[model samples]
Target chain A: MRKFAALLYKDLLLLVRDKAGLLFLFAMPMVLVLVMTGIQDGAVENSSKKTVSVLILDKDRDEMGREIISELQRQDLFDVTLADSTQTASEVQQAVKEGSFLIGVYIPENISSMVRNEIESSLSEMLGLGSTPQTDTLSSLKVFIDPTVNNTFRTTMMCYLREASNHIEKKALLSTISETAQEFSPFPTDSMAPPPDLKPISIDEIAYSKDAFRTNINVTEHNVPAWTLFAIFFIVISLSGGIIKERQDGSFSRLMAMTCPYSTYLMSKIVVYECVCVLQFLLVMMMGKLLFPLVGLPVFSMHGAFALCLMIVFFCALAAIGIGLTLGTFASTHQQASVLGAVTVVVLSAVGGIWVPTFLMPPFLKAVSVLSPLNWGIEAFYNVILRDGGIRSVLPNCLLLLALTVACTAVSIVAKKKI
Target chain B: MATTILRIEKLRKTYPNGNKEVLTGLDLTIGQGEIYGFLGPNGAGKTTTVNILAGLLKQDSGNIEIFGKPVASDRKNTMRRVGFVPQSIAIYPELTAYENLSVFGSVYGISRPELTNRIGKLLDLFGLEKFRDKKAASFSGGMKRSLNLMVGILHNPDLLILDEPTVGIDVQSKVVILEYLKTLNSHGTTILYTSHDMEEAEHLCTRVGIIDGGKLVAADSPEALARRFPECHDLKSVYLELTGKELRTMED
Candidate 1:
């Protein structure tokens, strides 16, 4: 026990002296979070230019069909394409299914005449003179929609299409009434009522959210936790380098030459690196809490965030230290340890959503990202920062990170034996 | 039974890279409190033997007994009573000399109070007391080497092995180290010494073993080996007579 304490103390002393290492471990991540948030927020500012692809299959090919298609094109929200005449409706549906088009609009045959006939009958009935109202009126349009489209985008497209149909119907009715009122009215000419003022459909919006980040979230809410985890795991580099340095300097073998247990020496290194990682995590998170909101980014706090964060920091450090020790034990030189360690961490970070959020990744990549502890960690952070969730929300992620830590430590122990 | 401290019989080791044997059925014995010189050229497996004894590497075949206990592959308990001052500078440069000694002492199971006293006494004995608090990184080569040796002997092991301890130091520093080692021997610490300096070995060693190509060619006192070759009066000439002057630039 005393030897372990001595070993741990000495390791801590050496690590504290490495100023550059500490900076890279803590400050680098904080800076990265800020920089990435700034860039992503700039992107959010120009989000109105986003586009969704729509394919139109106009079998009606009439004045009403052309007008409705023109109105949709005018919205500037869609990259509109008219379907090829060579393809059947089923083929076009297949295209939509394959994600080639976000939505497909198929207008039925004679839809313009059908709409006109319905309008004329309605006018005649109101005048109490002429044919009965048509029972089969064309009011529905066939829309082949991509099921995987964003909910917001799908809602906007559906509303636009509905408004176009309503406009066509209203224009068709008003014309029919103007023509018939002069010729068919039995009431006195002066008593003929002016067309009732058409009231445009209006929407009233109400919001009932009490959560802070429920209304909207910016890049800061995502990046602060993301890059912080990324930065903490990068300790693999310095930790491995330190071990390789010890081996190169012969202190490693000298330590082995003593009567001390290998378990104590190995455990001391693991403990020290874990402590350093936890300390860096706290420092980065504290910076996020103090500095992030000042920059006008969305920020929210959940109760028990501190304890949950500490648990994450510990498991994350353990996992990173495991890799560090494994690489250290196998690497024969400083260059070997540094190069291999850096490559490994960079790859993990890439898949783990440091470069891009796993939610936005392609289906396959997103599925693979689930195996990345960094992705798990980012999700836990998002639960708290965006959903107002607490420790209970992040428990599963913490457990998985712990499992990875154990696995990595096991590999490290095995490798340490060969040395 | 001359109170043997170490016994190696038919020990053999092959390098991990294969195709070569480093130690080939070598045998040696050292009695209590005697300075036994291990003389060999480079790549002659002296360090390999010491490593095996210190539990850093395993022998392919053979047995080693220290104080009647078989030296287990790990040398865990047996190592507590043995010390190895390696050829390289093993002290942590970032640490102060005192800090290095304290840590090493604790590893050998010395209590903190006793370790403190041992550090003070050993530092003063080696003339390192004044520089004890300074970082070892700033020390001269001689000071580093001296501190390296200080760490090994601080535990007061029954058996102390010095692997070319005086390799690259000033004559003054070398004299202090040699004299200190003699004093340790007088106090009943069995010494296993390796050096290229023939004169120093001639003066210090009670018995000598000449090893070449992982095999022992001769074993006796300097005078006795010299008497075998009347033309060789000095230990270096006697060593040359036994091991030859062929340059061993490659592993055997």
Candidate 2:
């Protein structure tokens, strides 16, 4: 322990003295989070500010049609445009397909009257009256969505339509029940009776994460973890260079001639660099939390257990340091280590969903992404921050990262012996 | 009658890269308190032999005993009594002179107070006390070399192996280093030093070995070797007489 402490202290001194290394570790990540979050937020804002143009064909032309139109308009994401009475369903579909509108809704003719008749018949049957015969009529709502719209937007649009349908049905059912009770009243009831305010089934759309107010992940939440991981893994460049420097300068040879085990030297380097990675993460996160809001971006809010998030970050740091140690051990010179380390990190970031979301990647790249330790790190972060996942959810990724650390450390140890 | 500090018998090494045979059945031994100068031209296996003695490289086949125990059987314990100063300036450039010595000293399991004292004494002895707080990268070549040497001997090993310890240094630093080596030898520190400078070897070595083509051509006191080659005037002439005047600059 004493010898390890000495080695650790020496490495720390060297790291702090390297001004360029310190800057790369801390400053680079902060700037990346801020700039990337700003850019992504601007894109989000532009897209959201231009509301989706929705065309509605109300063949019902009654209470249900008006209620649906009013409800769709209440949503901030939609721009509801009522179609002319002469326009057909095919015309609305063609308009949406032509990109004139993002979505088109068609309400069947006499749909509100059918709903009122169905509720009244059900109520009369419940009161021991005979059922009334009804004519066959179209009862389904038809919606046409632009194929270019992504699944998330399509799903959100469908959810809002369903909500509107539920609201109108509930309103019609209560009014029918109130009217029926008045006709069959045994006591004299005043005309000032308040309408039933009962809501049998209300559906509220919310983000699945810990924060109920968060309808969806914002730019800050997405970019902060992604860029921070990229910067953390980038510690390889400086760390591998340091290792090669020690070998070329004969410090490694001198140390080998002593009574200490080789593991001591390797451990000292890993411990120091891992600490630097953690510090980099904290610095970037703090910038996202405090500095981002000042720059007109949303604050980076963590939605998972803080302790679990830290554990994932800690494992990620270990994996990054392990790669650094392996690169330094195998590389003959500083240039070789730096170049190979940088390229490896870039490739990892590329396939690991750093530049794009994993789901957005093609099939082959998405399959390959699982092999990257950075991918594991980002997935784990998403699980905690975006999914509000607990230990049970992130345990697999954490274990995989830990396994990578062990494997990489093993390689380094074997290579150092040969050196 | 002196205690044998190091012994090697039938030592052999063949690098697998180009199947190059660097050492072939070489035998040598050094005794306590003897300044044994190992001299060779380029590619004569001087660095390889010293690296093996320092536990930096594994021999293909050899029997090496230091302090009367087999080095292979107890390498860590054997290394505890040995110190090696490599040809390159090996100190951490980003670290202070004191820090370099302290780290290396701690590896030998020295107490903090004792290591500090030893580091201070070494710094004063090497005329590096004033630069103790300065990073090795900022030091002159000679000062860096001095700090490198200090790190090697921070634990006061029983045997010190140095490879070109004074190369690329000023005359003043060279004189001080030579004087210090002599002082260390007088205090019973066995020294195995390798150098190409015949004059420095002739002045400092109690006995010197001249090797060429992976074999020791001659081994004796400088005066005795000169007497043996009566036509030669000094150790350099004796070396030339035994190894020839051909240029030896090829890769070993």
On lDDT, the leading prediction is: 2
**Highest TM-score scorer:** 2
Candidate 2, residues A1-419, lDDT tens digits: the string is 88899899999999999898888888998888888888989988887776778999999999888878888889887888999988988999999989999899998889888887777777778887677775356398899998887676688778877877777777778887777777778767566375566655667887787777778778887888889889989988888899889888888888888856788888998889888878887887778778888889998877536678778888888989889888888888888988999999999998999989889999999999999988998898888988878888889998998898899999988876775
lDDT of 1 by residue, A15-75 (tens): 8777788778767887887788778876876566788888887777886678778988998
Model 1 bad stretches (over 4 Å):
A46-216, A300-304, A387-393
Residue B61 error, candidate 1, Å:
1.4
Candidate 2 positional error at A161, Å: 14
Proportion of true contacts reproduced by candidate 2: 0.85
**B173-198 in candidate 2: lDDT tens per residue?**
99988999999889889999999899
The TM-score measured for candidate 1 stands at 0.80
Q: How many backbone clashes does candidate 1 have?
A: 0
RMSD of 2: 6.2
Q: Model 2: how far is A271 from its true place, Å?
A: 1.5
DockQ, candidate 1, vs. native dimer: 0.52
